[model samples]
Target: MKRGVVLLGAALLLGGMGQAQTGSAGSKVPLATGTGGAVATVDLDASRAAMRILEAGGNAVDAAVAAAATLGVTEPFSCGIGGGGFMVIYLAKENRVVTIDHRETAPASFTPTVFIENGQPIPFDQRVTSGLSAGVPGTVRGWQEALSRYGTLSLRRVLTPAIVTARYGFVVDQNFRNQVQENEARFRAFTSTASLYLPNGQPPAVGRRINNPDLARTYETIARQGAAGFYTGEIAQAIAATVNNPPVAEGTTLNVRRGNMTLADLANYEARLRPPVVSTYRGYTIYGMQPPSSGGLTIAEALNIMEGYDLSAMSEPEAYQKYLEASRLAFADRGAYMADPEYTDVPRNGLLSREFAAERRALIGSQAAPGSVPPGDPFKFQTDPSYPLRPAPAGFEGNDTTHLTVSDRDGNIVAYTFTIESIGGNGMVVPGHGFLLNNELTDFDPVAPHPNVPEAGKRPRSSMSPTIVFREGKPVMALGSPGGSTIITTVLQTLFDVIDRKRTLAEAFTVPRFSQRNAATTGVDLGGENTPLAQGLAGLGYRWAPTPEIGRLTAIQFNPDGTVTAAAEPRRAGGGSALVQSGR
Candidate 1:
């Protein structure tokens, strides 16, 4: 009875949580402003799902889980329980920042030579569709542990929105349809996958409702039985069986490989709590995920190097040159050093040290450095090597990922980025689970002596950068994105825009992004390769390549007047959704 009263009062606190929906499919607002709390995601339904939790007395952790689960339903192609991810959380009461590493792990049977046959490596795409590409999923355990550790809500409560979203379904948009169309051939190869996504033997039309009753049931069982429901029960058996003996339809010409996943691998899966990577740039404190994921360390190192230059004092093009140079140097170090920490000794603190940044920044000349550069030794920068080596790992050449940001009135914040690794995730849905398994294992380099090569029970190195920024002991903003290795560059550029360039959140999102990652040619997105900026940079010996898109970033900022600003992309991935408590 007491709980009921609390619920009623909480529900009435904000009359707009449910009524905040401004429109249906294509009319979502990219930037939202309000007083209490806020949520931002790539999908409108997901933002509303998180907002509902906030309106019902849930904190940022609760709302984030709710948002993530909702994304699992709506942004199914990008992320799901069948994949893995990274989570960074700010516990307001404790005033501490922490991270969860739920990245997918290689099966115990995995070896460095797993992807190598004869003297050559198997084609990467062939491995992707095979069960061998799937890693032991970690999203479910990450969610369960997060709720248990810092949330006022239960797993069952947080999962309610996702179950509802999956059961009744949501509106299909152009992006969803396009993704299906893109993976048409892959879908046709698996009957279970084709049955769910291609109901009429074709992609569903845009604006139509697509329901996943199987996924809803999957969620319901997990809600009742906890992580064990998926990791150790009947579902676990089903997952292993599907991976070991793919349910490919007869007459499918594609030769799919088998995985060595076992029921014990599922039963033993665990999400770990890792210390957050902390760095300071021009007085603002930044917190991000540690290695096994290189997003945090790489961003910190680049920003630390950029801090040497007074960007605000330079011309736009000059600043960009320095930005590109800083990114290049940082990525050189990332490619050479980063990997799963439990597998190798990482030179973490040295990579992020002020001295190392100064040394690396010194390498940037008046002209762009040619091609890929060698990594600098950061060991001398460390006073005591207090940090685990946390250099950014080389990102896989894939970009299908999703991010969400949430902040509560009480100051708690969550920045989460997750993925199924590649579009449509190896193109094999669980036999009856209605979710695609991740192709995360393909993230391995497969080269001999490579730190990121596959190893028994090793987590794949990732570039999912979930970041939180603090000003004078209080969290002022949170952000993250999904674009494999480019994720680090994307977040760093946006952070530079917001903190250094003094651009509004919306304006920052509009800037044409240039991503340089220690490559001979930098990738440009939201702008063509023939832009004036590109032409001008060509004089400096910088080369350019046009990438379709870079990243889909979501962020929330705490304003001085107590209002929160939630921002998303307006033109990418059919735009995104940003919502606040009441807009009052």
Candidate 2:
């Protein structure tokens, strides 16, 4: 690893560009309630930045974009311009919900067998550190489109907070340090990555300031030149070079494969505008992103199944069992049907239909599936319900992503989830651009004859479920999270908690979680292995292992008393931040 890095020089270089931000470095609040506006995120700086935007008269979309950009700096390992995500927006004035699908797209050179050779797939972990794992990023384009379409501020105006955060920097905390330590070996393989993240050949000390003037300059260019600065000129070329021919250390032992990305792919990228899927459960209408993301469909189907039962009438443990069973049933269909809409004909209507959910619900008996259940048949589609599933070729997705929720005084709301697909993605930073590349392409299935297999310019299916709930034509809640696939279950369970069990938002988030994603054994992040719930579930044919943690969720609720409440994970991601424009 490199030694004696000078992160301090960045502070000196950017000192004259603008005044550094104040009152955000130590702004950590896990829950806040008030009126006018609200913001919740997994980072102090990010949440504070959004709150500042709201205070400046920006709308929810503008504040959300501001928060997203700041997360690219403070939560660098999880997200940045190198990645892409889905944004769900509720426009109260228009009385409708719209979604932006900026999910990453594979290069034109990609093919179904890109990850396969000689009838075998590349080792998942080996591919994670290579150039072959990145996709054409869509975040910058997504941000530009959002601002042009619905935002009240310019890109330059909204990006000021992120630019300042990058220039002046934020203090490194334990979570940030722990993430670096976990990726140290891979980070050391690339000179550019190691030089910035691994100061003194180790994770930067907790409470130490780390600045990135290069990133600040990059943001400035995009601010001044709009998306063109990122997609058509120097920045785009740098990204392509970094992905096609990685900048590894001189004597590295890693076998990083070259990628297929090019300038054309970057220039041609578009953040497609999609209509949000609408589903109702217990009299509330839920809005979520459409296909190219299974989150909406899976969660809607699970909620439909859940609606079939009186979860409110059951004991806590009984409700947990039904939730697990519903999760498994939903994941079965997800594994079998969910994929990029452009390439795969996803059964949108059938998947979300109450009839389909009822059919699938019947298969869930008094006991869980003996091992794993197969996908059930949906209406208007002819297929055998018992078709054998292809065994998984590789498991490579990381539970690494960041979610932010924002709502303004006028009632506009946004729930955004973006990610680089893994912590310290690709473990290689663009030489001077000062950002990590995403391993998002690793989310694609490795083989052919599968809905999720890679295809030229095809966006990989994502599990990001940014959701907003509306009751009587007005938004009641907005929420999302950053676990890989467990994201679906996380959002589902929380929705059930508040709507069915009458739990407070804070109580819903604090409770232990049991995520069953159609797996033979449910992953238990519910406190511990020896918990009473765990012991009691064993008798019902349930098997589980400890997952340590599940997901860090951020949510905002529009209350009946004309006030708003923002809540974040109190114990996840070193505790999250929830800040309102004014205190209650």
Candidate 3:
């Protein structure tokens, strides 16, 4: 380990010696280093907490769990135990990659028309805050499973920093304050929420110290009693009650509908270990979360399509066009076929097959397609003639999520993306838990008899693309981002930047992002809109819309010489990346 650390440091120094200056702001962001490990997350305190775990002799999984726990306290609006996520781990010793599905599942009492009223859907605002939006959270169980299966430390030990931060307090930053203030009306709907977030009748001022002893107690119970503590006992009861009988402010008449989740649903929730969606792109193997998550398959399909084009030789505008076309095709399939495989018969094999990609690739031309593209018949390539080809359904997407990437000296890596589904999720906090519950159930379509319709115990499809890349049978990169449906395109763009354009990890993250997603107007960042890439697409009959933000990517890259580089998206405030040398 010590020797590996030395070689890694030397490689980083050499890699940084004389690189050409890029105009991207991320180029100016200093990279953090550690001899024993490295961590990149959206919160500085969370990164430091994870680094402390590595320094204490924990491995990559342990540090990841630690950072995840801390993020719950620090970035509560984005993620917490009340939510669920996916984790992709690269086990260095075993030379294998593993993925864990901790995605929240609909309650057993749910039905296809749960969100439908009369013959139409309920109002978006009411549904967003109502108990009907909560799912059986899977985050706590996921953390426990990862730790027990691959970690070097106990849950009690790994959760210490988060527990301390929640009990004592952490300073609120401008970003956090702004989020709170923006959602003040929603927070005001619940007494428990307002008490914790809007203390003294307003959102905590920037840099103000905030504490949540109740949340600390909840973590304490989990530490002492394991996953059961959160899923089956007092905490579980609180969660159920909050969802089934939500508290409304006086005279507010929320008219919110109750959810069907019971204690039994919470108790029965189990995180699964699933096989990752694997595909090869330019000699590198990409692994991502499978069904219940459209990220892996969509990314793989996009890359396969672009592989036929010489992206490196093409002008910026040409490359962007190819990317937009690929995204359109993949998202069309996402709406048609992507869903929870346990409940739906998704043509997984056909979707990731190169031949299937070729069939779809033939649809793209020098000109952009008009309006939203329709999904293709990939199932036609399936060997199973008896397989059911269900009709695909369109569903809403969410963007409030967080991601963390970590790599230890031992070579193990973790790429995890978790979320509460929306900002201040459901606007309901478990009475004393000091955390927000996810609206993941809304990810399902309100229509009946569709692939993505709500169903008993079915996991909602997600676009959180927790991913890992390998070269020549060895792990090389762990990457992911948070941006709802945009996640797939964001990751696809960055991968192309690094692999085809030969940009550093920072440059790849800093580049302006763009996405089409089968929509009539392509969404581009401010910079992308002003570039020739936009004008060229417009000349090809494409309409463009400017997006304020696209993704918050956290990525770590491992060089052949043993050195590792990690970075958090520069676009997000409070983002952090740090590395610990092997001999630390």
Candidate 4:
């Protein structure tokens, strides 16, 4: 398979054009493209892996699965077979958008107070690193279901690159090295983790090659035997055993409550097919993942509220204020109402209703709200009276996930976001499996008697926003990001940049970002802090802080002339590539 060059500098090198200047930020992003197919991911290897499948005549879903599997091998800290996620796909033949909810589910023995002891909640670090935080993983089933349902390639064919990479190993880049250094102490605590990442009793240096034969075998088994290979065999036993009986480091006391996950839990897990949440903004239809993910509804609500304002006409400062206000209002409702739909009645219709957004829009004044805006009564607009209007509770989310977008010549598109929760999730490898388990259970509110509290067989709420945009019933864009709770705001701002400000795909991603998630102060990226927008916001009596990074957005845009453009986030050390056909 032939690959396009990924240029890194202020200028982007297109196929015909020598060097095209990007936005004001002077980004180093390589906006890859192809008339036949395009794939964008945070890792170059993963993007290339997907492109290989596309070159082999597989559709977008097949290429997406290949990319996702390759990412598990290369970027294991973010996501792997042990984690779960959401996928939003657009099928060209069917001319329809669909969503699959593979979010992790809590064990049947779980209770609202599972993370609580005596009358107080456990320390976050303790709970986050404990085996008790492991949820029933659904990523394997998700990959299998996607391939079986929509893909033309066999599982073995799609997973070859990942298996080979895991066996032969790849050089550790600066990003991979940095993550290992940051978590070196925690990695040292676990024998399995330490052995894989910490070579010679130290974190591997940049450019050092690392291999994981154990993970290679695991993937190879799944490829041959299908999802059952991981969910109902030795691999499943290893996952359950590690959770039920956690390993403790010498001279360190682990304050953890063990999980009661049996083999049955793994076998019973299933990825549900659901309808994608739909909304309209300036004649373009936006589709996103539904329940178990707060991203879709929250983004829709924010967009609805912002629709009342003319963002393109407003100055940067003025527009940012409205964006922040809308985000706060949407987050307020997200905290109170968004959860697993099967476990609780989420006011889905009312939350996304334009009428309800109008009511919330009235709350935004010339200045920001005094403090955290209270959640609105969306239940009043819906028929579900059982949906309680509860006060929002405080929770924590981490920016440890990866997102990918793929588009094929046939017009099929896939936008996927997956995570293992926090970095080096739970700090425990499933014995010899070589993949970290997710702490997704911690996404639930630790406090008892709350809407997002953990429940038996209940999926945890997520902020992974995999979105697709369509114009006149044809998909024009597919995008998503990974920033924990900030994912919604990042995606929303990008949408405004492209749709409202009329910026190119590169400009939309390169622009400075600001996020306010119902917090006392809004977080401004490094560039935003030095701009007049920051000063104007401060003068408006708003507190602002600097964030090193907000989110890593990977996007693919389809042009009216049948061309494809793909861009990856330049803020991080990631790249993208496209596959061109012989003709066209």
Candidate 5:
């Protein structure tokens, strides 16, 4: 099996080809048709809902919140109220860039020994599932905060589409069906999950009308009462009681039972909004999520390193070789110094400085550095790993996520990425909430000597890089994706292809891309692990897995004339781009 491809007992394939529809069941009608409107989301319904809100006097911020809520309904497997995420909003009127960090945080009761076994590392399976793996969810709180400060629509209105879909039901698109089938065993293993995800004793087929009344009730409660409904109300109580009160269900795969998770964890959770980490690459200013998320710094570092070389003149093989080298350097620094700024002393400013970036890039030779080049000296970043190095090897843990971009005619833009942190997270579902809790804690290293090693109440490093681009201090594009650690590279590459290489939004996304995250997952394997693209990279001194599959990416760029251009990844279905014309 290759990286980024779906792997499970059910053998479900991603990137399936099918006819596009207008979001209505079996209708060939297109969903978006406008000039000034653009939405890039995991599902067409989700995107259309946001655009509709924008059409109805909602600001970009308002539309973004609604779009995010809608995604929780139509694309539940990837993201929902059970998860936490990040958002980048460019407030046009204020001329400000704000980043909301609602990324999941460890429970207050979390301990370093949580995943340790007699002071040794725990097995992958144990570290992956159960209540212990879940973090304090912040999706609801995050969305609410974004709306309260920047939006004009009431929570009730912004949440209506999601509520309607959950109550009335909607067709189970092929992508949804495939995701369910792929994780069937995990879903079946837990009684709570089995009851809801497998309502009819099996996952629904494509076009099957699937209604989640439980989720509807939960959404209704949240919409009416605000974020408090999901955090401290009946919904929260039910979740805490259900998982902790288990009687050893028949098909459970977890060895440990119950574990400590208090309702306090939910109630005390709060999402914070901070300024985005910004850097200039060529003429475009890039804005991405700040620390606690290494994505922004790593992207800036990689782009800066790549700038040292004249990649355009290099052959395909040479270009790939340099790309891998630069990525390795970035990953090294990320592993060594990146962490949640609230908990660690990360040098945020230094990481994005021109001097540091140029110095880091100078280490890359014309050829592939022998072995993995360690992070260069802090001052100069030498190309040789035989010299002083950074941290030990990074681990490979798969996570699933969704991305959305919303922009209104007023020039406000919001780019967002949300995730459950893994497919069928913890393989457990909140009893009646109809969503899976995230396995985000697994993102922390189980062993020591790694900067992101598990710690009490510490946020793990993440790659959910919701980003925006500015030209002459004005928002020009908004994009993000669900590619696990590959997210930073993919988003950065797409932005480069668009602004630097002069590719259209669709063309930039469709163009062959490469990624390098470490030895376990690198850009040299660009075609992905099991595909022809990987084979091609392998022939060029890159040791990619035989399988070639890369992560799915969705993006939208704004044309100064007010037209919106968008592109959706084929992995999650609904790849066609939609544009909403200005109402004026």
Candidate 6:
């Protein structure tokens, strides 16, 4: 933990060099809007609607909930009310932070064997698809809870933008069309799905104006009736009726598979607020969503391991070597120890302890190995009883959602990330819902006894890292990203860029990104690790990642001068935004 400060100083020293700065590849700053010393950024126009609520005097909670609802329409492929996620909030009035774990839970009827095939385990791909894989959705429930507690806006008011977008029409973009085209085959597999998506038996071309009148109507119902309208109201009944028929209609969808889904599942679902996992490195505090999520622990472990080295003076290659070594070690701990705390007794504290971190740091060598093995730790056997085991066939590799950062002059901030699993999710669309259902259930480990095995109502482990940093009891940064597991790494690196390297928010985000999966024993897979500096690090103990695995990141910095400067990952169309109080 002591290394945090040192790393910062090192970054600052290096940043002061005459190295020329480069623009990010696919990152952009998000559009920001607010007033009275507050600012917010979201991925789409509707998200801005949520920010408008704050501008109109709503609090952080209200703005976040509004932003979430708006995303259901504008960023449907990334997130919607049908999905589940986590929320990290910094409450200015209370001077405290709370993490809402509205993450999806396994249904009671869920069982590990559901994914097995012909008396044997099924492949990860098959498990990632199909109806049996769906968990109880918490996206809407979670946001609603946030609104209830911290927002000042009404649900109807907050949801208005989503309603308007769905009712009329929104122009399709290249990314939108691309997502549809990519999933065309699977989308055609379900009749109802085909009716909604394949109106011409093909994806709409980019720039085409597409409309979902049904989804608009549904949104209106939801706004008027609250979450009840979507879960137990006519919308739920319509979904049930449609699900009873898998065939598609000429102009609508009936492709939902028949199954055990009942109104009870929707009505019974509720998002819970869980304590966040908190740790301090040097003088900075890092907080993340708890288990059923790997972000906090994995990030902490990586940082802990890195703390053991003096990476500042090392050349790029040397620094890269040490970074990769630390990541590898932490990933090993993540694979062996990380899981849903509700399902297993994860060693949350010990893993973050200074003594444990120091011991783990001692194991890294200056030479990098071609391939990696799980780092050994003697503490596992001595501390707690391990959870039941499942033979995880080499864990499969993968993938983002979208992120939003919000803050007010009062010091309240919210760092949030949302997703619909893969690009188009399950490719199942409810008539009039104007969005896709999340395949989030697929995030659960398909193997039995893995602690993350499917159970009705059990939330799967997620890589989403929505974080807020505090300094001397004041909120300093509210940031998060869209990369699956890579989200944590991108976020951590950005934190280093900000706190240590002294880079501006935009400059920090422009730095190239890299990542490793949830599994242990593998080096990071970099999407853009081919830089001269990164290449240099490959010579050190760090083995650079291969091509195409980096994740996108977006962040907003609340500077000491009261100005907010934001930056979005250049790898995507998204851009970051900032705001300042007029007097400042």
**Highest TM-score against the true fold, candidate:** 1
Candidate 5 lDDT for residue 253: 62
Candidates' C-alpha lDDT = 0.86, 0.85, 0.83, 0.83, 0.70, 0.63
Residue range 507-551, candidate 4, lDDT tens digits:
987777889999898887766777776888887767877887788
Give the per-residue lDDT of model 5 (tens digit) for 246-283.
42368566574455667897788889887788888767
Runs of candidate 4 with Cα error greater than 4 angstroms are: 1-29, 253-257, 383-385, 573-584
Cα lDDT over the full model 5: 0.70
Could you tell me every candidate's TM-score relative to the true structure? 0.95, 0.94, 0.93, 0.93, 0.88, 0.86
RMSD of each: 3.4, 4.9, 6.2, 5.3, 7.5, 9.3
Local accuracy of candidate 6 as per-residue lDDT tens digits, 1-584 = 12343243234222321101112112222423223444444444443444455555667677677667666766676788667788999887877789888776665666777666687765655544455545566877777788878777777666665555555566676766776787787778766567776778998877677777767677667667777877797777655444334334345332334434667877888777888878776578887888767788777877777776666656655665666666666766766666677777677776777777778778767766545445445354335654433323224323547777766556677888877777666566766565666677777766676656667667777888888877776667778877666777777777765655566766766666545443323334355456776565555534454645455665666667656654455445434333323322
What tens-digit string does per-residue lDDT give for candidate 3 at 1-584? Answer: 13343243233222321121122112223354324477788876677667667766889999999899999999999899999999999999998889999999999998888888989998777788999999999999999999999999988778877877786788888879988988998899888888889899998998789988888888878888999999998999999999998877776656767887899999999999999999999999999999899999999988988898999898777777888899899888888888898988888877878898998899999888887887888887777653655566556777789999998878899999999988888988898777889999889888777788899999999999999999999877888888888888888988988998888888887677888888888888766777765777788778878887788888888877666776786665545444444311
**Model 1: pairs clashing at backbone N, Cα or C within 3 Å:** 294-392, 346-389, 347-389, 348-389, 348-390
Candidate 5 ranges beyond 4 A from true positions: 1-34, 246-248, 251-256, 377-392, 520-540, 546-548, 570-579, 582-584
Models sorted by TM-score, best on top? 1, 2, 4, 3, 5, 6
Compute the lDDT for candidate 4. Answer: 0.83
- Which residue runs does candidate 2 get wrong by more than 4 Å? 1-27, 379-396
Q: Compared with the true structure, what per-residue lDDT tens digits does model 1 show for residues 7-73?
A: 4323432235443444432467888887777889999878877888887889999999989988988
Which lDDT tens digits does candidate 2 get at residues 1-584?
Answer: 00111233233223321111232234576788878788899997787677767766799999999899989998899999999999998888998888999989999999988998778989888778888889988899999999999999988878887888887888999999999999988999999999999988889999999988788888888988999999999999999999998988888888889997989999999999998989999999999989888899999999999899999998777777888899888888888888888887777777787788888878777666766677776645433232333433323468999899999989899999999999988888988888999999999988777788889999988899999998888789999999898788889989999999899999999777778887788877846557787777777788886786788999999899998889999987688998777665
Preferred candidate (TM-score higher): 1 or 6: 1
